[model samples]
Target: MSNRGAGGLLGRRPPEEETGLPKDEIFDLMSNHRRRYTIHHCKQADGPVSLSDLAEQVAAWEKDKSISELGSAERKTVYTSLQQTHLPRLERAGIVTYENGEVELTNQTERLDIYLDIVPENSIPWGVYYLGLSFLSCLVVVGLWMDVLPTGAVPTLVYPTIIIAAFTVSAAYHALANRRYRFENLDEPL
Candidate 1:
């Protein structure tokens, strides 16, 4: 075989072609706090969201206040930003459709979830947690291999079995935690 291209033997294709948007542009779109809030609100919305209403929600979140308590200045700043800049950018990216003073997420928006991993505040990053787990597992295996730690009547089989069980349980918990961050479950707190 002379070649093994990204899209099979046919040939390599750009990520933009495959995912409908380039990874760089996707990252660029997510770079702004307001844009991120817009996407999050749109995902939680049942259907098309009015620009003014969306701006209110975003302003409230940004100010850490209830919608009813939002000042006109806070709402106006977010509303103008969304109307003039954020929505048009998102519309061009095909992640959302903006029309008739309303906004709705498009199919292309689904492709973005992979980039939008929402790690809650004060929580350990999953990568760091998994790395620590793997390291601890290795130490256990090494300890047994060198006889530095005693099993104390526990069978040799039980050591690796415990390790496997730990991994299995951790993986299951990780999966469930991830699902909670998804858009469909936005009704729950992050």
Candidate 2:
């Protein structure tokens, strides 16, 4: 049998539809710094967050100051931008619901997290660290094979075994840490 159409014996259905907004739209929604900040705050919020509070927090971040120290000018500027520009854009993208001076994340919010990986400043990227580890491991293996270093002092497999084990453990720890991010456990202590 060569038939593989919809009515054919295989009867394969269409591909499963994506659950939320399209990826392009999600990226567009996250393209702005203010909108991204709003989503981050909403994710940590216990419930619907007042727009005023959200604006204050965003302003503090922009000014590198504490919320208590945020001037009225800074707060008002951020508040106006959010209300007149960013919030409406986010609302249109279905990523958040804004109403009555309060904003809440919708189901589309979960999609944002996958795109918003916030690495702290002055931190080494994990890929570079892993690559360095791998290079060192390979160098050690080559040295052991060529007897360039002490050949009889230690077992040949020990170096590779330790490197592999370290990589595995590090991967597991990173996964656990990502899964236990602040937004996922607002009620739990870090």
Candidate 3:
């Protein structure tokens, strides 16, 4: 039998594999500004935040950082870093919870702590998965063209259709999941 204890508020097993390291790792990873913003928003006592709020805060931060004039490229870099790098890792660690229209923290302290051990080295580039599907779909289509597979047994259009549908749905799900823990503004003193 697994080592996971029985179900209780905090005793329940994490949705993913458990690591032996202490939970401080989560906070350590949060040492960075982008990662810290995500954690503070989700785990903060105030409450959950919306994606629009997050986007707005990011925009405001960009403006505030300008000495005289703001660089669009710099602002874009921050935004991209938050959305592509920090948030995805936090989501994978299960520190943030996503739902209908808001993001909140999952109150599993033990699990949350355990998640700290596995710092997300990089955001999972979902676009790569879509691209892979596209390439595979093309290959399957080519096979059909060469008559490698029996005609009518498998529809020529089915592969690409499935790839498109799967990628679309998965991307949507990931977006929603990441958005769950987003806080509107983190510039305010916490």
Candidate 4:
């Protein structure tokens, strides 16, 4: 008889407790490649993307072909799947709003960024990289303090300055890479 509402037991937290969609819901939504493509297209678009155009791009990517090379059948198949399954689920999750044959992202779309980490292949994750850098810097400081490093003859201020410089440069590079890898900025005009 408890009126737990749509959230049910899986996520019955009050409004303030919700950051975005629940983690399970997000995983469910992103589990399908089609849905990921749909989100990518919606994010890249400056305005709502028409269903046909979105399907065309998605089909093209799926088939490894250009949009112009996609057959009507391929486009239709994707369009149907998106219209009947993927899009509606996204709409319900508040990740997207679908209406009038067009799709646009909702505020909830931003919440997925943490899950959709944009690390390039062979590149270390930013958090891990930063942690390693901190550890190394700590080790260097310890060495300097113990007079174990070759920098024993170096100025005391040089150690702190070098450590600060390393961090500053890493932060700047991370900022640039963050912009480059952000999904919304892909294929978008500057």
| Separate clash counts for every candidate | 0, 0, 2, 0
Better of 2 and 4 by TM-score: 4
Clashing pairs in 3: 103-180, 103-181
Which parts of model 1 are misplaced by more than 4 Å?
1-4, 8-15, 146-152, 183-190
* Cα TM-score per model: 0.80, 0.67, 0.36, 0.83
The digit string of per-residue lDDT tens for model 2 on 16-83 reads 12324665776676677788788878888889999999999889878888899988999999999999
Q: Which ten residues in a row have the lowest lDDT in candidate 2?
A: 181-190
lDDT of each: 0.85, 0.76, 0.55, 0.83
Candidate 2, residue 39: lDDT: 82
* Comparison by lDDT, 3 against 4, better one: 4
* TM-score between candidate 3 and the true structure: 0.36
Best to worst by lDDT, what's the order? Answer: 1, 4, 2, 3
lDDT of 1 by residue, 1-190 (tens): 7567666456766658766887798889989888888889988888999999999998988888899999999999999999999999999989889999999999877778877867777999888998998999999999999998777787888888988998899899999999987744664222
Window of ten residues with lowest summed lDDT in model 1? 181-190
For candidate 4, the TM-score is 0.83
What's the distance in Å from true for residue 141, model 3? 90
Give the Å shift of residue 122 in candidate 2. 3.6
- Give candidate 2 misplaced runs (Cα > 4 Å): 1-27, 64-74, 147-151, 172-190
In candidate 3, what are the lDDT values of residues 125-186, reduced to their tens digit?
Answer: 65676678678877777877798856687776776677678778878976674554233222
| Candidate 1, backbone clash total | 0
